[model samples]
Target: MTDTAPSESTAPQHDALLADLTTIRVGGPAHTLLRPATEQELIVTMRDVWQRGDEWLLIGGGSNMVISDEGFDGTVIHIATRGIQLVSQTDTTLSLRVQAGESWDGLVAKLVSRGWAGLEALSGIPGSVGAAPIQNIGAYGQEVASVLDGIDFLDYDNSEFVHLTTAELELGYRNSVIKEGRAGVVLAVYFTLTASPESTVQYQQLATALGVNIGDGVPVQQVRDTVLALRASKAMVLDPNEPDSASCGSFFTNPIVPEHIARALPADAPRWVVDDEPVADVVVPLGETPAPPPPPKPRLVKLSAAWLIENSGVNKGFRLPGSRAAVSTKHSLAIVNRTGADAAEIAELARYIGACVLSRYGIHLQPEPVAVGVELA
Candidate 1:
């Protein structure tokens, strides 16, 4: 890779503290920190670290990570590369390739300004573009998976760069192959956005915020503005002045359970049918007869994690005695660092919340952020 002067934003640092880089502001220092400003530099640096078999971790935006207080023993590469290229455009649709390090909300804002639809409802979500597909980040009713065309990935297993399509990612509710076991890094993301000025609002909260009904079309910019306001009210947006914003967005993913288990919960618990098994279409040979199809399986229900936590006796702003970690004052789904909390305290609070929900509902709540050298148990 060719050497280039680093910008102020991409300059490398020695013995950098991970706490300064992460959103939660609690991780310990890194032994070494490297910031790669270009895609070529990132690849070369990562390959060298891999060849040496040195312990290494990739951090981008650092919004969805929780690192231990003892800190990591190896190199930490902070992705800083940035660029966006419009690959092709038509009257109705356009494709853009974005560098992995591009800010997600920044991209959404740009798209909204350009009258590009599809991502407006996802506004205000934090982190880098490359990290979006790892969890298939979604807000309101729009998810990155819905607009993603593919990604340029650097696979760690074979040390090769390959482009993979959206279907190949096997994306689902807050999950994908990358989050499962496919070891790799996303170098760039490709998105296909509509050229429409307005988008359909699908979420009830969003529709209400915009003073419209669900399924009604509203200006994309209006949708983005309303979503940002809603997130700010819940302290989901990142702001230095907002103490509750010092968190990893939603700490837990909504639990998806079987229909029977959902019915076991108290009435008025918010639950939605996420999916149901499809009946197979049986066909008999030219014999003019067909066998009956099997009955459909039980539907899966997604329960509101915030509602469960509240009902389980853990209310918003709840904190363990003598602990610095507490639930967000505005949103029960988030665990915020209330004044210099250590990673241990945060993990302890998470474990406590999980126990409460499990004891009350028999459903284990899964954490959304990736934990490093720390256990929620």
Candidate 2:
């Protein structure tokens, strides 16, 4: 593919693409914006956006992203590319390939309805399937990486297709090469799903809520439903009317500390083994674990970011003594738009909540949104 400059329009239509595209109703416009309906068009348009020396921001469902109020300076390519093909299937397994533009939740919904078990625990995360591996999106004790078999990407530096393995993705807590660096746009993803109804109920809260136990198999659809319900309760699922769900999912990855530090917390601090390997020895909860009771190690145990924020005195629907935005009334971790809000306002509010958490817990909270053009710092 080659670059081609878009027809000139000075009205900033390029940037307006995000006005309604993302969950946060904030952000400026891209100097140029294009939505490629197909891979070919996406590539061609992207080539032009790139070769023109124009800076670019690639957006998908815009759910998990937070753009700056100032907006993107270069071109913005909103990938609407689509396709979800079950290229092959077997009695106890399936080989599915999904284009980057496919809605992540929509696909999971379909798979669940079909009795597919692999992704049931990750049902409600907002964003496109392509963006899933970008941050190794996870929830309800499951992450996308567990089912990811291969990834197809457009390597930005080389401008070519690259297939990567799970190892190459370097999956970590809400982090991957794509989320951390300028990895090229994902084209499609290939997943090898199991045929048997194998699943891990690693999250204790979810199991208890579902009245199931860890390692006990449940219908994939049930898992999906339960997960989505749990997420909605936490304001993690996207809902137009729910202000808390308007922001990114979890605002921070659970902090994993050394065992000694984790053990230093009070007897009630939550602790769990991260791995079964004898060498594996780190466990701390961000405090989202349900039904486990308040972990004894509020200080030594990694407190739930939500718990810390609330306990630090920032209650739901909290606003600065004088501010427009507020914390979600339903979820403490989310900085929300109680009314019409702007990016700058959100950033300021986030900083306030973060400062309060730091002051009280001495733990720095990191945002989960892929902040762009905006400085949360």
Candidate 3:
């Protein structure tokens, strides 16, 4: 892979408006756009952009981002390449290598169609394979972290490609080293999936939808369809005709807080205790000896952002005075572009909602999307 000019064979139309490129549809224009069609081209293009000291943004399906109305003043690299290959296979597991730009849900659909069982519960997510591991994307109790094998990424500062194992990425719930800006641009990703034809049903909502109990197994395609239906109901799927779908799927992540903080919320508030580690109590017979009690458990809890927002007095479809952006009619977690709103309008609405939640619950809500000059303050 030798360095060269950005390949025109795959470049997006010059200076495409950020609003047009992104799902949120509220940003301004990008100064320059380059879409690389191959991994080598992506590396060379990014290297050239970096060497020139020009600010650059890497975008895939643009589902989880909010750009400024003033637009980016530098180069924007739009990953457009696509490929998926079965890289390795074992008796019980299969490894598939996919380029950065492959659609996330599309990949899941393809895998499920083939009777692969690791990604069925994540069926309706919108984004790219490269972007999935950055946030450790998850849904319905299934996360990209569980299936991720490794990633081929470029180290811009060193102008070299590096292969990173899953452990090195430090994947946690809705986060990873890449999300923290430690890793460079992702060129490709590898996923290891089970050979079984049955998919795991770990989320209660999904299990209920599928008429099954948690921990039960179902056909992978059935799981995928059920997940997709659940997502579409909340306007989570990207559909141009659906006004509520013009926003990023979820504006804020479900807040993870200490157990005490979670306990302070209303009794009916949606909260789940997440155990960071498991400790089995060891019992010793009285005649023999006494074993010391296990160390105190770490108490962490996940709170629903939607619940917090609604409890804070912002109802679904709520909006600030004279604002074009509003909460989605079908989901309180989304901040939709209700009326061709600009980035500022959306940012203002987000701040208002956040303030409301903070004032009422004493807990600040943080946005999940990557903002480029779009201030939530």
Candidate 4:
């Protein structure tokens, strides 16, 4: 597609505060803001910004982003396109192609209502479908990677639209190629879901809430309701009435460390094995039989960030003496804008919590949200 500038009649919003768009409500004004309401408009607007060589930013649901108080100095394109099409279906399974701008939780709700199981455990996640693959968003022991089939991507380098398979996306623990500096935009996401009425309860907390044991099966709707309840209790779900929900859900991701590093932490620290080295298959001559592979090495352990923060002497609801930013009273992982706090204050709280965790555990905590014109240092 050819790149062209938007007409004067279609000029973007000028001096729009990013705080109005983002969930955290802490950023300054954007020099220019464009809300593309369709796939074609989104592509055209992005191409125009690129061709003009103007600095640009893309926002979806704006749930997982933190912008500086000084604000963005360039164009901010908000993805507002929405649609959900059934790509294919069988008696037992179905593939869905969802627009990038579709609300993630909304989609889960619809899927559960239809008795399509797969993403019930991810209910109450606040963000757009496009942001899901970028963050590999997950909760209650189920990740986007588990059901993702592929994505229709717009490559920034060539301005070409291409399809990327799940393997090509390289989704990992809250990470993917798009998050790893790959310059591209996800236009749509593909997911394969089952037409099952029940889903397996894998997370301990979720199971306990549902009065079931881990590995037990429960109705998909029940799982969604229970997961939503769990998220609301932690203040992870976005609710206008809940002041604590004004912050980004889980500001810090659980850190995955090598087995030895995890061993150094206190025995009481919550951790789970996330990955392990795979044993390579032995090769032998055509006439000879291959011997068995060696045992796998110690696996990588994922440590709980909330536990690390609390144990580091930074308790829930803790805040700087003069700052309006504070740790969420309901969950230590989140830093909330207690009252009209600026981006700097929020960043300060995050840095302090990270430093405290590093000092106590010797493992640095990584911020989960995308920081724009803001430094955690």
Candidate 4 is scored at a TM of: 0.94
C-alpha lDDT of all candidate models, in order: 0.91, 0.75, 0.88, 0.91
User: What are the per-model numbers of colliding residue pairs?
Assistant: 0, 14, 0, 0
Give per-model TM-scores. 0.95, 0.87, 0.94, 0.94
Query: Which model is ahead, 1 or 4, in terms of TM-score?
Result: 1
Candidate 1: where is the Cα deviation over 4 Å? 1-13, 277-289
Per residue, candidate 1 scores C-alpha lDDT tens digits across 271-307 of: 9999865665666789677766556677899999999
> Over the stretch 77-188, how does candidate 2's per-residue lDDT look in tens digits?
8887899888799898898989999999899888877777788888888889888888888776788888898788888887776788889888987888888786588889
| Candidate 4 local distance difference test against the native | 0.91
Model 3: runs farther than 4 Å from truth? 1-6, 10-14, 280-297
Give the higher-lDDT candidate: 3 or 4.
Answer: 4
Alpha-carbon deviation at 71 in model 3, angstroms: 0.4
Query: Considering TM-score, which of the candidate structures 1 and 3 is the better prediction for this target?
Result: 1
Task: Name the TM-score of candidate 2.
Answer: 0.87
- Candidate 4: the clashing residue pairs are none
Q: What is the lDDT of residue 336 in candidate 1?
A: 96
Q: Report the lDDT tens digits of candidate 4 across residue range 155-192.
A: 99998989999999999989999999999789999999
lDDT by residue for model 3 (249-282), tens: 9999999999999999989999998876767667
